[model samples]
Target: MPKRIPLQRRGRAKPKFRPRTHKSLGKIELPKQENTGIILDLLHDNIKSAPIMKVRFGKDVMLLAATNGSRVGENIMIHKLADLPEGSLVCNVESRPGAGPKLIRSAGGAGRIVGKEGKLTSVLLPSKEIKKIHSECRAIVGRVAGAGMTEKPMLKAGAGFYAMKAKGIIWPRVRATKKNAVDHPFGGGGKTLGKKKTVSRHASPGRKVGSISARRTGKRRGKK
Candidate 1:
């Protein structure tokens, strides 16, 4: 095969857009549920705004996205509770007992069991996608915490650099056109990379820059 083409982002290769999470956060007592699971430590991850929630499920331990003020040592029921209060964070909620929660599990992500229809329970995810899960699948109540994280401005390039450094990421990328012609497709002679910015889908690595395989070029004229 042709080296199994790697995915590209905006004509360039980049890493996944997720934060690096910290695993160790010392030790803390977990909340005790009568017969259910309990939420453990609330810690900070590489993603400044999206907090992490540690919980224990039937001897298996895991870290979930912190939401709805899930605090340390709090009783969290993993299945069918008296009532799922508004702004709760739930996961592993499947139609079948062991299907496993498969939706809306992300940083600053959440879902709610809005309505019930016989066996299928309607859950509106963070993306506003409606999914049907089991009534007894179980979820945690309360919105994922760390609200207003995205509202903060980067302010300066240095601030952004240090922030991404915590996650071991390279920040403040340079434009490809700024390099020499031998370096990037848009590179060279004048301040402008090139008058044209389109490339073919089968272009080689060095020449594969700008609009790839675009069907049309230039702005379209309005109807006469």
Candidate 2:
């Protein structure tokens, strides 16, 4: 009899696979109105690689991504895209006007404002994608702090395991071909699957292992 695949089990929403979010301070949200805030403290959240800042803006207190050179008692300005000049670096940018920040919140990440056309502002993301955002969208005016956090090697498998556990991600993933035939679709083969792995986007759970709904498969050939 075939056993349930890892993908199927993960889809079942078991507690072991669920992310642990109880330790999170709160969502990194921007205020509706642009306001200057003072960083009261810097703290770490288990699920995040970047340090978080507790800031007070008037009577309202909120958590925000810690920017490079952020320090306690330091005042920071949160501004809209229209207010920032071109070539400025920003993080935690809102995806839409008044929607709050939704991009570039990763540690050491920042998006550069490259150009503007009418009401749309062009932001160059770290992935090299140029996204057009509304000029009214707000963003923090700095790069996320804790650069080079991933540059250091864990040095041990145990260290890697704990790090993944904090984010509730399964570590040391076993290849499908490495599993037994009854356990995985690509199993029973040696190192190679000996078959095309692409499947339809609407394939059944047990048959949805690899390259689902791919536009094309195999190595690309260049024109001579």
> Tens digits of per-residue lDDT for model 1 on 133-204?
666565555565655667789989999987886664667666766766655556677778656788889987
- Deviation in Å, model 2, residue 224 alpha carbon: 16
Residue pairs with clashing backbones, model 2: none
Residue 94 in model 2: lDDT: 95
CA lDDT of each prediction against the hidden true structure: 0.59, 0.90
Candidate 1, RMSD to the unseen true structure: 6.8
Q: Compared with the true structure, what per-residue lDDT tens digits does model 2 show for residues 38-148?
A: 899999998988999998988888888899999999998988899899999999899998787789998999999999999999999989999999999999988999889
In candidate 1, which residue ranges exceed 4 Å CA deviation? Answer: 1-35, 47-49, 80-102, 114-120, 131-138, 153-155, 165-169, 177-182, 189-195, 215-224
Q: Number of the top candidate by TM-score?
A: 2
